[model samples]
Target chain A: MTADMTTDMIADPSGTRSPGEVLSWSRATLEPALRGAVDTLPGSLRHLVGYHFGWWDERGGPTGSAAGSGKAIRPALVFLASRAVGGDPLAAMPAAVAVELVHNFSLVHDDVMDGDHTRRHRRTVWSVFGVGPAILAGDALVTLAMDVLDGHPATSVLAAAVQDLLSGQSADLEFEDRNDVVLPECVRMAQQKTGALLGCSCAIGASFAGAEPVRVEHLRGFGEQLGLAFQVVDDLLGIWGDPAVTGKPVFSDLENRKKSLPVVAALTSGTPAGELLAERYATADEDLPGLAALIDEAGGRAWAHQQADALVEAALCDLRLADPAPGPAAELTGIADLVTHRDS
Target chain B: MTADMTTDMIADPSGTRSPGEVLSWSRATLEPALRGAVDTLPGSLRHLVGYHFGWWDERGGPTGSAAGSGKAIRPALVFLASRAVGGDPLAAMPAAVAVELVHNFSLVHDDVMDGDHTRRHRRTVWSVFGVGPAILAGDALVTLAMDVLDGHPATSVLAAAVQDLLSGQSADLEFEDRNDVVLPECVRMAQQKTGALLGCSCAIGASFAGAEPVRVEHLRGFGEQLGLAFQVVDDLLGIWGDPAVTGKPVFSDLENRKKSLPVVAALTSGTPAGELLAERYATADEDLPGLAALIDEAGGRAWAHQQADALVEAALCDLRLADPAPGPAAELTGIADLVTHRDS
Candidate 1:
């Protein structure tokens, strides 16, 4: 094994590792199996997948860097949720790998739909590999995700989440051409698009751990609420995040006029600034910074921050209801906190 | 129930039915459950899927005709394979529905990749719905296919076929940019692209029928060879079938410079006509009829016809080896004949 792969296997003697350490350890545990699954892909698709995962460059050469890999938050959720229910995190490795694959599959396709040029400080898969190959890459990942489950009872769980995810994306695309998107509809879209998979990650993890129906339900509730919080925070990042940290153009979502949570909230809010922002949005104005200021002035930013905090608190209540083991509970709480508070 | 649906449920008084009768009966047996699964999709995706299935127009109104729906050949294969193994075809309805969903999923995505605007005498899903929604429609169909399996043993069977299908498509996309693709590689691509799912259809159906592994394997062999024959005939139709019958523009494959089996066979034939055809294919010349004539002159057409005949013979041998019941066996034979002999 390479040094990079082995180093993360050496767990800290300390019991209370930070969320970052937890994520690193989870990724280390998940990599071998994930790579093995991807390696089974056809050569043409394997190259694009590896490049998307930051294991290699576009030419199939090693990049010698892991900076392009995302934080792998979903896999971490899977591992921690399994451990929280008093199961060996190792037992949930397939669930972890499957959720991560599903997450990346959505990312690859989302980039194609949004016409985004960059991700994780590198060219997006569609931008680097062309649209057709990128679509195939996404298709391969989703198929592999189902295959990895290998008829485990959790297959239904994952498949339902996938359907919800696709439905959410369909709504997102439909909203692009409309001006009357309400907050409830927009929130439902976010839940389906982002929350469904996250909820599936926790539920599947707990199910793999042989948890009872009640515990799995509670864990799913926790993950679903946290997922909404994550999406709310993501909208915040899309508008005002530092470009260097987020690895996207400043005001990227606004540039595409995405009907994101914050923007929709502001559009539906009955304020003068809200009206003004809507007008500018309809006119194809290039004043993105000006529009961002208007959304903030219209109370969209504050409403989003409030929603994230409330959702996170609700998620913690569900976590407690699950009666999780103490150590993993603490780690899950820390991860949840990090999700809402992260700058990117 | 609607008259259209109830009409085909009536059994024939005679002991025999034509291949067309078998297909229509399969479609009738499969529609309610198939529509049930699709109706579960979120509204936005459901509309697009229904339109693509020829149940509705783009505005979501009834089409009042089934002309645009392609033959449910895969489902027919599934149902016949089940009955051939002495199981009730109705008992294998889920398998039949799942395979047909997978078939249409591939078609929806293939249209996007090939930029095909027309299918079955109508506009394709992508052409009518736009690219992003069409992609989601394809995603929904494939996900629904697995969901319809619902943790059956056939889940892995379907998943494996999906991977091979994606790999075949990847190879096809790669071939579009290269001139050195050989005959073996091209045939492998066709087998992966077309044969894998058809084989899976038969195997899954036999499995659902509680057939032994040996019988299932033989049935799969039958379907795979038949699938190759089906593809070879499809390539032939792409070149020479009348547009009024094929529902494609004249010389569509040659117009796109598709490296189909016959074209690749001609390119590697080592004949003077083959050399001339290769030279012509290298340019931007629009003499599609001339290209078609050259491919025929190079013996590509004859070779493909011979191969299709050989494959059908091999397929029949496998069918007989499975020890199928006489009635379903005859129907299967008729379907295979129709596949290899149809103009469109």
Candidate 2:
């Protein structure tokens, strides 16, 4: 899995590249391949999915700016893991598309639930298309994800992958209203929400390539760990990163009184600052600056960062164990670095 | 088809039938089967899906009023069609549940879009659970629906069914925004929105039983025609049925500007009444009396009923050509009659 050999990675001929450069390169290559599948949609539907992906203008024309399509991190991990397991990354493209579609479906619906107006620096699907069309679009995407997976290698394996995605999504939803959500609960949610898709990506890739059972299991473990690490890093950035880089307002989660991993950890941390932060969060909409201050003072931020570091280390260790093909494995290693270190 | 044989047509021998009696009976029979396939979900997720189905209340206790699961029309169609094709209906239960789950998933999302507060005479999932969780619930249902099909039948057939579902849903979303909808387009929308699922239901049922291609084609045709007729009749009811009996506002389609089939037909009718109906429909609001009078005076309601009658006749004609197995075919005939005639 050598990143240097990948066409997507090759787009940056400049010898010097930042971690962000790696993320963008991985995403850039993956986007068109994904768009290829979406382009196959009926013309009426093709534009709608395209709009949701932020590739189309409001009137359903192409927008030209390809920057806002979210980091295609999950798909890249999938492609990398596929090559790592000795499979062609292209063979895993459908599975990669499936996982990404599922992720976007969640985002569209989440925006509606949170009453959010903007995503990727523009109006959300619900905001632009209205709630009915937005819900239908999300529904269509979910069905499309499964439809994409239908061409996967075997019935049994595909069935298991579908089950994993559903179970993960179910757990993530359950955690939303729960005021008592704990670190363990959040970890479990991570497994379902992120880990399941990652695991499926690897498993489907391995199955498509006809890898042995031992290799499939090993790749699955690598992806599960990597997915958890990815979520941990995302949670960290959600609270502590710059608004400009993340394309989100500072302390946005606190404003929504969301119960992310860090907030949950602080609530049960048992320190005075932790207690104060918990009290502030309990009120839902206390002063945003004061809440951020309490969370930082409580050491919640540090604890979250430390946890992310540990998980990333664990993920990398598993990646080594999977022993991927040279080209894809190298890409996976770089992605693991990018995932854990991203400021946004 | 014998009215006595179809479950819905039978008077409750137990004398316990209620508003959601069919829904309750179907759930009791279906849940165990679904649980058998999805055995690995962690406890919390298992509970979340459970509550979504109304087997449990919001706090995770059994909801005493568990009767209102849904109409179960699609699943019952699957089972009945399987039987009518000389296959074991029990073997097709997975397919039945899968189709029903997808149907319910669409309904939950649809309710949110339409801003309808009640379903089955109870609060809709989105209204009760909030939009985010409802979206997740809908997503989980779709994922599970695919999984259910993935395990029992031919993988290729199941995959095709999922693809059709997605394509259909995508068209449904597009239709909502287009004001120039006409009869042909409405028929095409009906095929995508309703006929496709029913066709898949029959196709999967045949697949589950490993029926011959000829038999599968016949059942598919039967399901498609029956579904089209069902949608046509529903359009009539939407405009003309008594609000009290329908559990929906009278001329709900006019009020919401739903672009229903009769409305499309009326728009194309070019009669003086048709022209007036169109004018009022375009600006539908609380002037319900005026709108209702316009539709009745313009012959839109009568025209809708006639169109439904024609479709029902055509559907029955198709069923006759199929020569379905006597017992289940008889049941489907009766079910079709019930569906087409019901005010609701």
Candidate 3:
């Protein structure tokens, strides 16, 4: 949470400095272009977007720019992937900005669809402006993203990614209503919703640098697998991470009855614990801790963690195909470590 | 309403074939690509889109493809303008499909934002599939539009138009909250919301054909002016046209308390009828026909019709600059006539 990256704000138990610190370095360079592009939004949308970024308080009061949690992660992929491929990070700015804008547009509309009110401890755009304005603002951001991708062949990559993102989101929403969500279905949904954009970011950076198509596809594969791995690890933290460190209650995802990877895994495992957990879910919110334990006992947690590790390994293989520089490649390895191993 | 394009369905008062007939001609070529693009939407979205396009009823009952009113007009502009500029209309099919996709994207989101339940005499996507899916489908369509526009420099033009479209929609939602709306402000909003995509369609057709910048600009101006003129005429009809022709309860726009062009003009005129109408708007929806009369008495209808005439005149001047082929040029003139003079 600290502006100064040297502070051990994001640390591993073994005490090595996590490469997650790369986010702040990229954020500093990416901030001006992001703000300038957001400023171009018409009328009150400038304020709504400002409010979204936490640069301003909900009532149109300026709060200066606050880093949106995990927002910098995708853009970090765009920048570091550029550098890893021997491309200038600054030249990849438009791709980076467009990726971030695309991410925010999804978030804005997602909140409206889910009726979510707050994120990063602030009111959502739909919560502040009416639904209509927020929807239009999201539309404007998509327009801006397309505009930024202009003159670059990477626009096709971004568009395909966006379609994939929406497809995943649609499936996720559909999954919420059915108790029949299987593990592979959940994983594919996660990849579609989250991995596609990450994949696009990786490919678009190389694309803007005029990299060979084969190398670009390799980077895309690496980022996509990395994204799926990251989501699995995040779902893990939502359940079992220490509240004192993570600041979220234990079994957070379970309490909300989210059909996340682990939960879906346990529910469809055909084990005694899985059956009990599924039955309990249909009832009230009682015994959330027991449900969490059932998922763990049913091997859901271990299964998810193992999948994350395997995906990360596969992602590393793809990263090798891209033939990235050793130094930046090492940073990517650190990022993978940071994603899969962060205790907090 | 009928399959026969030769029907006098959208007849001008004088016994002549309406240029709305041109939509059928353009639809012949554009429909296949348009359906193929929409089919790329994942899973249930294909069905939802099918419903939105009137290919299915609410229960997924197959309906033969029905013409979506006004949906074809923008694509028609794209195809006709391409031919008008001496480009082969067949070569402009991608631009035509892209424009229609963009238009439908707006329509889907606009219905969700506006909270309307029905469009095209059928259930809306949100009402049937749910809001989340509808919103996601709209996002998917926008992505599809960008994908279709790929490898074309007209992509930038489409992006800019989408931005302008969003800007207009935002201003419109904002204007609904404020009591003061001026004539010029309303006109600009109309231009932004309606004119932008229309202008985009016109220019994209030429851009696809590798038209010079000056010709593209001229065609864009013509389309934009024509859009403004169309809105003016439509607004005039909302106030004074016979309900039997327009298919609405008398004063439907006024009854819904919409801040439409004529209503805004009459509200801001500073005349006695304007003051009376303004006071009436603050109260209940009683006497909507009377409110419509006040708009007429305040010179709102006459002024709107006059502005429409002027804009069409100005539009024709720009159309001449494009130096369109005579046959296609006549079609454009007929379209202008049909839009301005339609009773329905």
Candidate 4:
């Protein structure tokens, strides 16, 4: 494990550990737990799931098998929430598995719908296997995830989680068509697209702990706020983070013409940046580069960063309301801050 | 509704009801159930689902009413099986809704994959709404079905049902690429594609009734057998049924060069009839008329009819093992006979 993967930090700004240390530790603990679940899929489907999980090469062979797997941040948050409520993180394992699977399933399908050839520096599932097989694989994984929830969690909790995932996905799809999405709408979209799953994850963990309904609600709120903050940070990174650190090409969102939180915030600015970005989105694909420059000149980047900062502050407020016990909660809050504040 | 929609005995002799009647009843029950659930979707997604469900016209406006909704036979089986097993069918309503939604979700995606333009004499969801929106609608419905399952059934039962749906879908997709599918393999594929969901429906009903595991297994077996019989009848209709009765043009299997049961059986035939049929299957798309004649000469229709008859007998044998007490069980038996023996 990396030396960076075993440190702790307090929630307060005055906390001592570096952000990288907390992030690394969260990654260290979450990867194996999520990977173990992925490895447990039936033989017929395991190879496809593994390919999506970044553990297998195209021909059902093993990839390098190193642990640059997905960030695992979502699963970490789930486990952390469970522990914060004095529940065993192990008890929340199935939920962690479910949420991660749903996330990956969406990724596989979204890549197809967007016609994105590459994901995580490898050929997307649809690109390598053809659209039909890729679609089947994604559908299978999603079904399997719901099935896993059958094992230990309460049916109500699992149902709620699945509902949240669907609602979020529905909102995300809706956002694609609108020409004028505002900050509040984007925030709501982020909640549905990102917050719903996170909230469900936390709620599931609390259920396993046998926490009271009020407590579960509190944890859900904390998760929702955290997710919103995470998405806002993601939007900022889409526009401004260095390619090497973010592992995405420069101007990637601009090229896709994604109306992310920052772009939406800038559009709310009702200034040149918002107008330029909207004009670029309406323009033909061939003219994107010049339009992207106009957007940058209009302060889209700075406005997006400001939005991220505000969301992170709001998330901290929700975390305070949860009033979790000191150790795990502090560590989780620190990690949330790291996620909301980081460049990558 | 047309008189044809109410009753047409010779056209559906083995079936308990005519296609028009069966289709209409299914529409009546499922439309209200589905509308209740879809009402929860956001404006954009709600509209998309509405259009796909045949509640809207080509221009995205409401059609003033729903028409041509799919036959909700799967949901009926779930409810019928529940009642047959002495369970309160009302308790299984959520699951009944779930199975039907999943079935429709598959139908939407399958139509796209198969490049089918019309279903029930109406343009397909993809044909009207564009592929992107249709895909989102399918994904939304699938997730919603999973959510619906969360409400009423036990977690384990719902999970298992979801897994069965996915497994069945996987096998069906696998069948598309397989040209060497034999009779037993076809039976197995049918079991996976159709039998599994039927089995789940039965098992879920048993769960509601607090039935013994052994009894549940028997009911599941009955459902599985019935499902296979149902598919075999469908295969027969694909090749030789009357257009007015089936709603599809005759000899569609020949036009699509589909590997239906009769085609598989004839391929096994070493007689002149078999040779002629094989030659027809090998012919180009432009040779459909001659191919249909060749298939008829090969006794493919008779062979398929015989196979379907045998499957129906087997299904009845399995049902007897369940020993379902009078009313609902008898009605279910009657329905099975209709599915297997119906002309359309």
Note the DockQ of each predicted structure.
Answer: 0.71, 0.40, 0.59, 0.32
Per-residue C-alpha lDDT of model 4 across residues B1-344, encoded as one tens digit per residue: 34444322322223344344544554555556678887766566677777777787766677775555656777666666666677766667677777777777777776666667776667787787666566666776776677676545344554555555555555555655565567676666667667777777777767666777777787788777777777777877777677666666677766666666667677656668777666556657466666656666677667767776776677677667777756556666767777876783
lDDT for model 3, please: 0.80
TM-score, one value per model: 0.96, 0.85, 0.90, 0.86
- Per-residue lDDT tens digits for candidate 3, residues A44-163, read 677777777778776777776574434477787887778777787778999999999999989889878877666665667898887888888788777778778665888878888888
lDDT of 4 by residue, A1-344 (tens): 24623333322223334445544555555567666765655454566778887787878777886432567666767767777777876677677777777778777777766677766767788887767667766776676667666545354465455555555555555566778777787777777777777777777777777777777788888777777777777767666766666656776776676777766766666776667667667666556456556556667667666666676677666666666766666766677778776774
Query: Candidate 2 residues A1-344, lDDT tens each?
Result: 24556664564333534445555665766787678867756555566668878898879877888756888776766666666776766777777777777777767766766667777777787787677666666666666676666545443454455455555555555666566778886787777667766776676677667777777777777778777877776677677767777767777777777677777777778889888777667675658777766776777778878877787677667767766666566666677777777783
| Candidate with the larger lDDT of 2 and 3 | 3
Candidate 2 versus the native: TM-score? 0.85
Question: Where is model 1 more than 4 Å wrong at Cα?
Answer: A1-14, B1-14
lDDT of 3 by residue, B162-244 (tens): 88888888887887777888878899999998888888888988887778889889999989999988878767766676755
Q: Judged by DockQ cut-offs, is candidate 1 incorrect, acceptable, medium or high? A: medium
List candidate 4 stretches off by more than 4 Å: A1-44, A66-68, A151-178, A240-250, A285-289, A342-344, B1-32, B56-66, B151-158, B175-179, B241-258, B266-284, B294-300
Q: Higher DockQ: candidate 2 or 4?
A: 2
Model 2, range B1-344, lDDT digits (tens) per residue?
A: 23234543432222323324433444555666765643444454455456656677767787886555656777766766676667776788888777877777666666666777765555677677676666666666666677666545344454455455555555555655676777787788777677777777777777677777777777777777777777877777777777656566666766677777767776677788778766766663568667667666666677767766776677666666666776566666766666677774
Candidate 1: residue A62 lDDT (0-100): 97
RMSD of 4: 5.0
Model 2 chain B: ten consecutive residues of lowest lDDT: B10-19
Ranking by TM-score: 1, 3, 4, 2
Sum up the clashes in candidate 4.
Answer: 3
